[model samples]
Structures are given as structure tokens and as C-alpha cells.
Target: MSANTDSQLAKRTDMKLFSGEKLLVIVSLIGFALAAGIAVYISIYGAIILPEGNAESAFSFNAAMGMFILSIAAILPVSGLSPGKRASVRWFFIVAALYSYAVETIQHLRGINPRFSQVGTVVDQIAGGLFGVIALLIVIATALFAIPFFRKRQPGERPLLVLGIRYAFVSTMIAHAAGIWMIVLQSRYTGEAGNLIVLHGLGFHALQALPVLGWLLERSRTDEKRTRQLIHTGGIAWTLAIILIGLQTALARSVFELAMLPFLAGALLLVWLVTVVIAAVGLLKIRKGSMVQTNTVSGEENRDLV
Candidate 1:
């Protein structure tokens, strides 16, 4: 087949996958709406109606935001899958998103913590237990969706993006492990100084951070070898940072405490940040160069027409 024909076929397949992503897109929008509503409500009432000492607004808001972020992150991975696998994962996302939204919104409105509430009734506890199950389902779905990225690069797949996604999935799994730890302990705190939530939150964001870096690098027109090296540098740094943070948390020490472990983690994070900045600069330069070249071509064409 002609290269043009192959390209056209790939485009059609991509379009079909994109169509399947609509449900997830809608779910993400709902999450955003819910988060906005909760924020507005909190601003208006200032916790007057919320249960005392529980930070209901914050919990509800964070839940909504998490749904939104995860849905958005899932889109690319879902699109990378075969049609049958894509459909299954897509449905799993819908179920998990809706379940989370309902449980978080309802429980918070009823003056209970959905994940951990000593004062909640039996039903509430059941719902919280179900929430944990849903979380495990999400982790499984994510792992399935991530499989395609690890397979041999298909025709037209961007190398850097795939590498970034692999790293992101690994880091996200670590984040999920941290979440499971919280579920087992029934607390977000590890000890006097440690807060597992910090590790959880930071680890989850590797999904957005590393993949985005790879996407940007793909467009940056940097050398292929250099781009791959940078992605590896960033991914390794990010993973090491998460590992250090996890170890610190497990040791009952604060992630930000003045200690060697925390300091090493901070330095690794800084290294990742530096790589991101470098990629951003490369992207900007390439875009600027492209714009100038386009303008030049336009001017030459105009002269030819005249």
C-alpha cells in the first residue's frame, strides 16, 4: 500500500478511538462542574453548614478534581488501545467516575467523610468500602490501558510519548499503593510527622507531568537521541523522587523535614523540573522558527503571484 493510503487508514482509526473518548470527556466535564459548584458553595457559606472539623468542602472538592484529572489523563491511554479493549476500559472509567462522584458528593453533603469516618453509620461504612473496591478497579483499568504503551512501538507512534507514558504508569501505580496504604490504615497520616497524602498526590501527577514533557519534546524538533535521553532523565528523576518520599513517609518522617532523605527527594524533583524547563524552551524555539519560516514562504509565494 502507498504511504498515503496507510496514513489515511491510521487517521480513520484514530478518529474512531477519539469518538469513543467522548463519554470520558463528558464525565470529566461533570467533575469540573461539580468541583466548581462545591467551591462556590464553600465560598458562600464558609463551612457554616458543613460538618464541624471534617473539612467536607475540601474533601468533596478534591474528589471532584481527582475525577476530572484522572479522566483527562485516561483519554490518551484509552485511545492507544485496540477497539475492543478501548471500549471495556472506557466503560470502566465511566463506572468508576460516577461511583466516586456520587459517593463523595452524597457522603459529604450528609456530614460524613466518604473514605474515613469514625462517626458514619453502617451504610456509610459500606459505601466507603465499596469506594476502595472501585479504587482497585481503577488501578486495574489503568494498568490495562497502559499496556499498549509498553508494547513494541506501532507505526506512527511517537517514541518519546510512549516512553513518557510508561514511566507515568509506573509512578501512578506507586501513587495507588500509597492510596491503598491509607485505606488499610483508615488514615491519611502515617505517624507524628508523616502525611501519606502528600506522597499520593505528588505521585499521581506524574501522569500529567511526564507524558506532557514527552509530547512537548516530540514537537520541539530536538535531536531524537537527545530527546530520549532527556525523557529518561526526567522520568528516572521523578520516580526516584517518589521513592524517596515514600521511604520518608514509611519511616514516620515528614517529606519536607530537614533530613537527607527528604533533601535527596527535593533535589531529584528539582532535576525533573529543570528537564521540563529545557523541553519548554526547545518547544518555544521551534515554534518561533516555524512561524518565521511560514511567513517567509508566504512572502515568496505572494511575490511569485505578482
Candidate 2:
């Protein structure tokens, strides 16, 4: 087939798979349920039953929410893969999600932290190691899936969405680095006040935040040039925020400290937030305009019928 024909064919295949994307949805729902269960458990016990200095509630809540958001975000890119690749990747996510839930819930219930727990039994340590391995696998898989986004946009592909995905993947890699740093140090703390968990959490959220910005811009009926500019602004600001946070953590300084680095990072985040608000406002205006037009047409039709 010609190159154009090939693109069209791939686009059709992607749409078909996108419509059938259910496994990831199921996995995301399961993650939500696990998170809810954890919340209920915490409420009933009034504590997470972990050692001092360890925030078990944060750990468990973050894990569950991470799985949920990751699975939901995976649906789009995974469906863009070939049929065989899609099935394999989908199953990999399902298994990983399940393993993560089991390890996190079981370890917490046993009064053993699932990650970086030095005082746990041999089994707990082994489970922690396996969790790290699973994390590595997920990173590799996400990197691989990101490849398609960097390629030439296929027919019917939204350029802004692809661009946002590329940015999101890069930010996610940075976040993963924070996670690895924690693994190496065997703690989430760097200095007296620097917390790697803050960096890690912010970094991972790029996966959702950037893409949603792009999606909102795309649907707002903005011109392509303006849309691209807005996306670039938001993407760069978000990335800079992550980098600044990482740098502060690496310097063993708290990101919230009264320091220049923290100030710049906070400012970048605000810039991104402003862009998102702009896109959201544009979308609302478009929707409102469409509704008024539809109402006007309905009134005209009613007059004709009368």
C-alpha cells in the first residue's frame, strides 16, 4: 500500500482497538476500588499501623492512585499499538496492577511496609525487591509505548495530543528517576527537609496534566498555531517545574523552602495552571455558543411547524 494508504489503515485499526479498550478500564476501576478500601481501612483503624517516621497512609494512597491513573492513561497509547502488541501490553498492565495491589495491601495489613522497609521479615524484603522490579518493567513498557507518539502522526491523529504525550513521557521518566533515587537511599528523604516523594508525585502527574491540557486545547476549536503555542507554553512550564523540583531535591534542599529554586518552580507551575485555565475557558465558551445556536435552530423549526 502507498504511504497514505498505510496511514489510513493504521488509523482505522487504532480506532477499532480504541473502541474495544476495556481491559485497562477494568484495571483502573480495580485500582480505584483498592484505593477506596484502603481509605476505609484507615478510617476504621484511625491509623496505618506502620512504624514511626513512615507515612503508610501516603504510601498506600499514592500507590493505588498511581495504578488507577496509569492504567487509564495507558488505554489511549496501548490501543494505538498493533493487535498482538496491544494484547500483550494490556495483559502486562493487568498483571502488574494486580501484583501491585496484592503486595501493597497485604504488606500494609501485615504491618510491613511494601517498600523500603528495613525492619521487615525476609518475605517482606523480597516483596519489596519484586516491587522495584515491577516498577522497572513499567518504566520500560511506558518508554516503549511512547515511541509511537514521537513518530510521524498517522492519519486522523491529533498533533497536539501526540506532542503532549511526548512531553508527558519525558516528565514521567524524570519522576521515575526520583523513585530510583529513593530506592538507592532506602528512604524518601534527602536532607533534613528535602523530600523525594514530593518530586516523584509531581513528576508522575505530568502524564495526566499535560495531555489533558492538549485535549482541552484541541476541543476548544482554537487555531492550530495558537493551540501549538499554548501547548508548548504549558509543556515547557510543567517540565521546568519538574526539573527545578528535582534539582532542589538533589541539592538536599526542601522544594518548599524560602529559596530561589522553589520560587522559580512554583512560578512555572502557576504559568502552566494559567494556560490550562485559558483552554478550559475557551472550551466552555465554544460549548455555550453551540448550545445557543442549537436553541435558535429549534425555535426556527418550531415556528415553521406552527
Candidate 3:
């Protein structure tokens, strides 16, 4: 019965996505749903695992719920997006979501907690990684794929407010990805997991840099060089952050500090989080004053033989 209902629901969803005039709408809806689901999972997990009085636990529960609400609010508008943006960007989001799923599944199987070395910490890390991955995947795939696609397809399709809506979505995605890196760091002490952790961490956050390009794509339209520059700069920053993390993990000599190598990792996590916010907000500011305008020649109505 459940399987049948799920299939039916999926069919309904496909119909809505395929038949809908605006692909962006479908993209937004999917992204929104994905984000909301992550938030719920996190809130539940925190309530169950962490003690009632833990600040991180309580804050995460609150944060997840707040983010879930924000996702729904962001998804409300699906009417004004272009078709090209819809399919390409949406596909990117779906792929990213799938990739994150794979990453989390692997983590669950192999993820460890040096602090406890017990089943409880292992379970917490696995669950947390799973929940965090979904949120990061949706946010990034949408911005990196969908936003740029939309900007190109209908360069002047919507107003500044609309563009800002797009940036807000992207910003949230970067923030979530940055947060997930904290989970990645948990597994870094293991020599075997170190490389994988750093690789995935950088790869995931690399998507964050892509948004600066997406925002630029919206403004310059065809200035591929400028877009490339933004993406390149973002890539450099992304790589450096990963290097900082990798060096910290690889070079640490002692187990130290309650068995949880705290010195460098904690500092790097803080740096990563701060930059993530800065990048998100920077894109938002660059998109300021972007108005919707159509292109038309001043005096060429009936004849066109240029």
C-alpha cells in the first residue's frame, strides 16, 4: 500500500514538473522540499541524541526548523523562470543531491568519532552527515546549475527582487555546505579517512564558489570571461581552505585534548564558516540594483536588413 501510494505521488509530481510552464518553479519546489526534509531530520536527531541542555543541540534543532521554514518561503514563486534554466539547473541539483547521498552513505559505513570510539558517537556522526548532506546538495546544485542556466536563457526575465531571491537560495546553500564540513572534520584524524575527508570537503565547498559565477552570469549575461574569473577566484579560495584543513589533520602528532584533535581543526572550521557567509553575502550585494529590462532597437519596427 505504501509503495503504491509513493509511486502514485511520484507520478503526480512528474506530471506537475513536466507539464508546468515554468521549470524554475519545479526546481524551486524540489529544492525547497529537500531543504525542509533535512531540517526535520536534524531537529529530530538533536532532540533524541544530544542532552536536553546542550547549546549545540538546542541551537541545531532551532536552526533546522527555521531553515525548513525558510526553504518553503523561498519556493513559493515558480512562475517566472525560463525553460533552459529549469531543466539544466534542476538536473544539477538532483545530481548534487544524489552525490551527497552517496557521500553520507559511505560516511555512515566508515565514519568514526575519536572522542568516544563508541557506538553512540558513530551513530550521531552518521545521522548528522546524512542530514547535512541533503541540505548542502540541494542548495548548491540549484545555485551552480539552475541560476546560471536561468540567467542565460532569459537574461532580462525578472526584476532585482527576483534575482535576489535566487541569491538568497544560493547563499543558504553555501552556508549549509560549510556547516557539513564540520562533520567532515570529525573523520579527519584517521589516516585512511583524512584524504577522503579533505577531498569531499573541498569538492562540496567548491560548489560554493560557483555561485559568484552564477550571480555574475545574471549580470553580464554573455561575459564568459568575467564569469570565469569569479569562478576561478572562488576555486582558489576553496582549494586554500581545504589545504589548510588537510595540513592541520595530516601534520598533527598527538591525539590530544579529550581525544578530539581540537587545535587546528577548530580554527579551520571557524575560518571556513566565516568565509562561507562572506561569499554568500558578497554575491547578494553584487546583485544589487539589477532591474528587468527588454532589448529592442530604437527605430527598427518594420524592416530588418542590417
Candidate 4:
């Protein structure tokens, strides 16, 4: 087939597949239900069945649950877009979740971080090693694929949707990078991480946090321009907050430390200033574009009248 004919044929196939949109919705819904169900089961089991001292096992379990949630959340909306794009992003998430499930299940059942354990046999150690590598790859893939959502697009696209997607990406990328770094450092030398675990958990949650906040903002009957500004401002502030927490953790300082309180207050002020600057710049650019379009429309109307 000629190139044009091939393109037309491909487009026809996509249209036929996504025409009803019902199947995609059903698939996403089923995935969501499965994730939520597993999450609930795990939570109850962790609280009731598991012994209290197994910190590593608990972390693994929670990470598995979180990955499942993140995968479904990230895939559902993206599925509504172009099918090829949806397939690429969706598989990345789904595969990540599946891999996490395997690794966490192993950790809980066997009780070993294969990299550190001399007790485990070769197979177990190998699986543990594979877990870390797979996790790193998944985080990298998620962060990279999420970039397209941040790019400027037509006006009708909801600002909240864009901000939520980008925020999820940024937060996950940072959390995973920090976590992988911590793993490396631990392998090299056992170090006390004052609040590294707490920091990482909070940072990772921005995936759900900022996105839900954006969704709440969307429900307000605010002006679209104002909403966009709010999103940019809120997202930047959220990023800064996560960074500060990570930094404080790296310094071996707890957020609740008496000395850190003053710095935390100062950071809040800085966040406010930075958010204002970013929001102002976004508003100005939006205003300029609106004026230019308005002028063009007015000119065309005048010509018609004449």
C-alpha cells in the first residue's frame, strides 16, 4: 500500500476500536476495582496479621499497593487520548504494577532484601536484585512519558488535568530517585536516615495529593484563566515543598526539630513569593495571547461590516 493508503487504513482501524469508548472505560474501571480491592486487603492484613517489627516487609507491601494505585490513576485519563499513546503509557504503568506485586510478594513471604541477605539462596538474591532494577526503570519510564502532558495545548483542555498529570510525574520521579539513591548508600554503608523514609513517603504521595487538589480546584466556578494560574502556582509550590522535605531529610534533620521550625516558616514565605511570580508570568502571557486574538477577530468583523 502507498503511504497515504496505509495512514488512512491505520486511522480507520483506530476509529473502529475506540468508537464506542465503552471497552476502554470498562477496562479502566476493572483495573481500578482490582487495585482498590488489593489495597484494602493488604491494609487489613498488614495491620492484623503481620508482626510489628517487620519494617522492610511493611515498606515493600505499601510500595506494592501504591504502585497499583498510581498505575491505574495514571492510565485511566490517558486512555481517553490517542490509542497508540494510551497503549504506550498504559503498558508502562501496568507492567510496573505487576513487577512491584511480584517483588513485594517475595519480600513479604521470604523476608529478605536479596541484595543484603547472606541467608537467601542464589535464586532469591537474584530476584531481589531484579526488583530494584525493575523499579528504577519503571520510575524513569513514568517520568519520561508524563512530559507530553505538561506541554502547552489548545485552550479547552482543563488546566487541572494537565497540572495533576505533571505533578504526579514530578513527585514520583523525585521520590523514586531519592529512594534508589538511599538504596545505593545503604548498600555501601549502613547509615541512619533521620527522616528519609518519612520524606520519601510524603513525596511519593504527591502523585495523589496534588492531583486531587487540582480536581477540587476544577470544581470551582472560577474563571478559566484564574484556574490555570492557580494550577501553575499550586504545582510549583507543591514541588518546592517536596524538595525542602527531601533536603531536610538529607541533612539528618527532622521536620519537627525545634531549630527547623524557623527555616520551615521561611520556606513557606519563599514558596508564596515564588508562586506569585510564576502565576503572574502565566497570567500575562495568557492575557497577551487573548488580546492578539481579540484584535484579529475585531479586524475581521470590521472588514465584514465595511
Tens digits of per-residue lDDT for model 2 on 1-306? Answer: 799888776775464313555667776677677667666766777554656222355445546455544534454653356778867777877788778877776776767778877678898889989998998887787778677778876556767767777788889889888878888888889988889989888887887888888878978999889999999999999999999999999899899889999999999999999999999999999999999999999999999999
Residue range with the least summed lDDT across 10 consecutive positions in model 1: 48-57
Cα lDDT of model 3 by residue, 78-103, tens digit = 32345675555445544444444333
lDDT (CA) for every model shown?
A: 0.77, 0.77, 0.42, 0.58
Tell me which of candidates 2 and 4 scores higher on TM-score: 2
Per residue, candidate 1 scores C-alpha lDDT tens digits across 1-306 of 998879966754563323547677777777777777777766776544445224344544455445534534444543466677766776777778878888877777677878887788899889988998998887787677777778886556666877887898888889889888988998888889999888888887887888878878988988889999999999999999999999999998898889999999999989999989999999999989999999999999999999
Could you give me the TM-score of model 4 versus the true structure?
Answer: 0.64
lDDT of 2 at 143: 78
Clash pairs detected, candidate 2: none
TM-score per candidate: 0.88, 0.89, 0.32, 0.64
- Output the lDDT of residue 181, model 1: 95
**Ranking of all candidate structures by their lDDT, best first:** 1, 2, 4, 3
lDDT value, candidate 3, whole model: 0.42
Error at 77, model 2, angstroms: 4.6
Q: What lDDT is obtained when candidate 2 is compared to the true structure?
A: 0.77
What is the clash count of model 2?
0
Pitting candidate 1 against candidate 4, the one with the higher lDDT is 1
